[model samples]
Target: MAEQMSRGSQEPIRNRFPTLFEVLSRKTVAPLDLYSFYIYMRDQQRAVDYLDFYLDVSQHLILCRAYVRRLHRSVFEDTPEIEKNSKRSSYILHDAGEGPSGEKGSIADQRLSAFLRSDHGSRAQSPQNSHGSGRSSPAGRERPPRPSFMTLDSPGDSSSPGHASSSENVPRREDLRGSAEKILYTYLLPGSEREIIIPQSILHDVQEAIEGPDQRSDPELFDSAKDYVFQAMERDAFPGFLQSKGLGNLVPQSMMFRLIIGLISVFGAVWASFILILRDKPRTTRCWLILPYTVGIYFIFTHQYMLDPILALLGYSEYTLFDFNRMREPFVIKTLRMRSMSMLLFFLLVTVATCCIFIFVPGKDL
Candidate 1:
C-alpha cells in the first residue's frame, strides 16, 4: 500500500519521506540487509566491477547463493579496499598509513577483491531536488593508490598486473555470483545512479505495509548521509529488473499485476453489460441473445481470441500485454496468451448465464 495514492495527492513532500520519529514507531522484526554500492573509473578493479555485465535481478537468491559458493578462491591481490582481519569487518581497512603490507583475510574474500579500491571521496554528483533539476556529474576526486605486483600477504608473487600468471590474468568467468549480487545491491541506493528496479514482491510488500497500521512511508531514506558515499555506479543493458529477493516464481512477475488489473476491468465491463440488459424495455430481448450466435460462430471457426473489433472498441478489447510479455518467459506468455484467447468465450458464457438467471426464472429474481 505504499500510499497507493497517485502522484498528485494531498500529502506534503516531507510527509512522503519517512522521518526518524516514524521509524521507531512501527518497526518490524524482519532482519535488515545491507548491500554495498560503488563507482568505477580509470581502468581499475576490473574483476570487482565486472558484475556490471550480468546485471539482472530476476533470479537473485539463486544467483547470489551460487556466486557465493563459486567464489571459494582467495581474494584478489590488488583489492585492499576491504579489511582482511579475523575479529569483524572493519569499516576503514585501507592503507591506514601503517604501510602497504595491509592485513590479509581468507582466500574467499581475496578471490576477485584484487580489483576493488576504497571510495575515499564523494561518489554522487548531486542530489535530485524537488524542483526537477537534472543530475549533475560528480567532480572527479584524486585517484587512490593503484594495486602493485605484490599479493595480499607480506611477500612476493601477489596478484598485481605484473607478477600474475597468464592463467589467473584471464577473467574468471565461471564464479561471478558475488560480483553480480554486489552490483544489484549497489543500485538499490537512494538516488541510485542505476535505474530503479521495481521488484514486484518488494513493491507489494511495501504496499501492504503502507496500507497497514504503521506505513513505511520512505523505506529508501532509511540510510543516512554518512553511508551514502558508497553509491555503486552501473548501467543496465537489458534493464529488466527482477524481484528484490533476486529470484522466485516466473508466473507472477511484476507484469502479473497489470494482467490482474486487466482481468478486473473486463469483469466490471461484463457486470455493467448485464445491468444494461436488465434495463432493456423489451424483456424478450434476452441477455442470452448473443449465445446461440456464439455457438454458431464457434462451429464456423474452432476458436478466435479477440472480441469483434467493433465490440473491442466498445470496451471489449482483449488487452494484449506485449509490453508485459517482453519480461515473462516464452512458456508463461504462451500459456497465458492462449488462456486469454478464451476470454471472448468466457464473456459469452457469462453473458448467457446472466440472461438465463435474470429472464428465465419463474419467480421474481432475488
Candidate 2:
C-alpha cells in the first residue's frame, strides 16, 4: 500500500536529501529510520506545493512509530540528574515578570505577546513551549525531557543570562571534531551522516506529533497508522522462522538476562525447599524460614530490583518493564510453555532422587 501511494503522489524523498536518504534506505536501525521520516515530514510541511499531500503511506507511519520507540529508549536511558536538568525551566522573562527598562519586557507586554503567538503564530515560533497536541495553548506543565541519540559539539558560553541558563539545562552534545577526524581518515565521507543531525529539541517535537495524534479526529488514518506501527515491530521481531529458533534468543540480550535470573531463582527455591523437607524440623518452623525466601525471590525476579543500577546506567528504568504485547508473541508463548515443561521434568527428577535416598538408606535407631 505504501509503495502504491509512493508511485506518483509526491516526489521521492531521496531526491530531496539523497545521501541521508540512502543511509536510511540501507540501514534498518532505529535512529536512521526515524530521522528519515522526520525529515520527510518536515519537508512536506515546508514545501508549499505539497500542502495537499500528507504522510498517509503505511511504511511512512511505521517509520514515525519507530521514532516513538527510539524516543522511549532514550527516556529509559536518562539518569535522574539528567531528567531534572532537561525539564523545561520556568525562567522565561514572563515567568520572572519583566526586568527593568533596558531589561526584558513588562509583565503586560509578555502576556500580550504570548496571547498573540498562541492565536496567530506558527508552533515553530514558540520553540521552547511548542506542543503537538494540536492546541494553540501552551502545555500546562512541562513534560519529561527527551535527549537526542546524537548532538553537535557543545556551544560556547553566552554572556546573555537567558542563553546561559538554557545552555546549562539542555541535553549534552557530542564532540564532533575529534570523531569526524577519525571517520574522515578511515572511510569515505558520509555526507548525509554529517548533515543529518537532529537536535534533542526537534526530536521532542517529532515525538509529540507521533504520540499525541488524535484518533477520533481521523479515525481511519489513526487506526491504519497504529496498525502499521505494530506490523513494523512484529516484522522486525520475527524476521524469519529459523532465526526465531529459541525463546532465550528471541529478545534482546538485556531481556534475556532477566529471564535467566527468574529461572535461576525458581530452581534455587526448589532445591532449598527439598532440603528443608528432608530435615526433621517442625513443619511450621520450616515453613516460616522458607516462606520469606520465596517472597523475596519473587520480588527480585519480577520487579527486577537487582537490575536497577545496571538499567539506570543504560538510561532505562528497571521498574519500567517491557510492553506486555511482547509476551503475547507466538514465539514467546512457545518458549514459556517449553520452560514450564522443563520445570516439571526437573521436579520429577528431584522427587525420584529423594525417594531413592529414603528407600535405600538404612536409618539409625533413635
Candidate 3:
C-alpha cells in the first residue's frame, strides 16, 4: 500500500520534471513553465514583461471557464426550481384570500432581492458601462462592486444569522460577467495600468473571442496567445537566463573549489621561484628552473582569468576571459579540465628533470 501511494505521489513529479527540463534545455515551454521562468527572471533583475503577459492571459482563461460553468448550472438546473417555489408560494397566498403584496416574504429572500435590485440599479446608472468601455484608463477601469452576500466571516459560523442569509444569495449572471470583464480590462487591456505586452494580433483575437455576441467561453481562445508567448521566451529570454551570472551562483561548491586551487597554484609558483634563486648554483642550473615556473604561472594565470570579475569592471578587452557563461559551455569545460591535468603532469615532469640535473649533472662553482 505504501509502495502504491509512493508511486501515485511520484507520478505527478515525473510528468512535471520532463516539461521543466525541456524548458531549461532550450526546447519549447508551456504557459506554466513560462511562469516559473518569470519568477527566476524577476529575482535575477532581468526583463520579464513577456512572461507577465502570458501569466495574465492564463488567469483570464481560468476565470472565463469558471464563469461559463456557473452560468450553465444556473440556467439549466437552478432556475426551474426557483420559479416553481415562487409559483407555489403565490398560490398559497391566493388561497388565504391575501394578495402577493400582503404576504410577508422570508427575511433571507427579502434581503437577497433588495441587494440584487440595488446592485442592478447601480450598474444601470454607471456611465462607464463594461460592454462599451474599450481600453479605458486605469483610473476609469473600476473593479465591479462586491456582492453583499460575500462576507469575511467563515461559512461554517452557524451562529451569525447574516452569514447564513448571505450564503444563500447566488450572484446574478450579469454580475459574474461584469466582474470577469473588469478583471480582463484591468490586466489584459492595452492601456491599463497592469497591461500585458502580448502581440496586437493575439490581443485582438482574445478580445474578439471574449466580447463576441455568443457570450460562450471557449477554451481555445487563449491557445494561440500561449503558443506565441512560449515561442518568444524560448527565442529570446531563455538563452540569456541560462547565460546569466545568477545561474552560475547556483553551484557555489564548484566555484569555491576552483578558487582554492587557483590560490594554492599561485602561491606554490612564487615559493618555487624564491627557493631556486637562493641556491648558489651556476647560471645553466638556474635556467632549468624556468620550466617549472612557466608551467605553474600558466596554470595560475588561467585560473585567475576564469574567476576574476575585476577585469570586466576595468573594461578590459578580454572580458570574455572571465565570463561565467562561457566557462560553463561543454566544450570550454572539457578543454579546461584536460589543460589543467596536462599542465600538472608537465609541471611534475619539469620538476623531476630539474632535480635530476642538479644531482646527476655536477654544476660548476659560481
Q: Pick the lDDT winner.
A: 3
- For model 2, how does the per-residue alpha-carbon lDDT over 1-366 read when each residue is reduced to its tens digit? 222224563433221212322332333222123332343223322321111111222222222222223323344456466554543422232222232356532343333234322323221223223333344333323212112212211224231222322433221111111121222222212242222222445333333333333111111222333333334433432233112222222223334565566556556656655565565444454444344344334334323322322222223221112421122123233444555456445544654554444333343323
Cα displacement (Å) at residue 297, model 2:
5.7
Q: How well is each residue in 1-366 modelled by candidate 1, as lDDT tens digits?
A: 433433685432221223222221212111100011111121222332222211222122222222222222223233364544433332222221111355432232322222121211222112231111243222321111112211111214332223333453222222122222223334443354442444445434433432333322221212221122213221331111111111111222223544455455445545644664556534565444444434443322212322222222222212132211121122223333444456556656755665566455443232
Q: Each candidate's lDDT (Cα)?
A: 0.29, 0.31, 0.42
Instruction: Write down the lDDT that model 3 would get.
Output: 0.42
Error of 1 at 334 (Å): 1.3
Q: Tell me each candidate's TM-score.
A: 0.24, 0.22, 0.40
What value of lDDT does candidate 2 attain over all alpha carbons?
Answer: 0.31
* RMSD (Å) per prediction: 19.9, 22.4, 15.6
Candidates ranked, most accurate by TM-score first: 3, 1, 2
Which stretch of 10 consecutive residues in model 2 shows the poorest summed lDDT? 171-180
* Better lDDT candidate (1, 2): 2
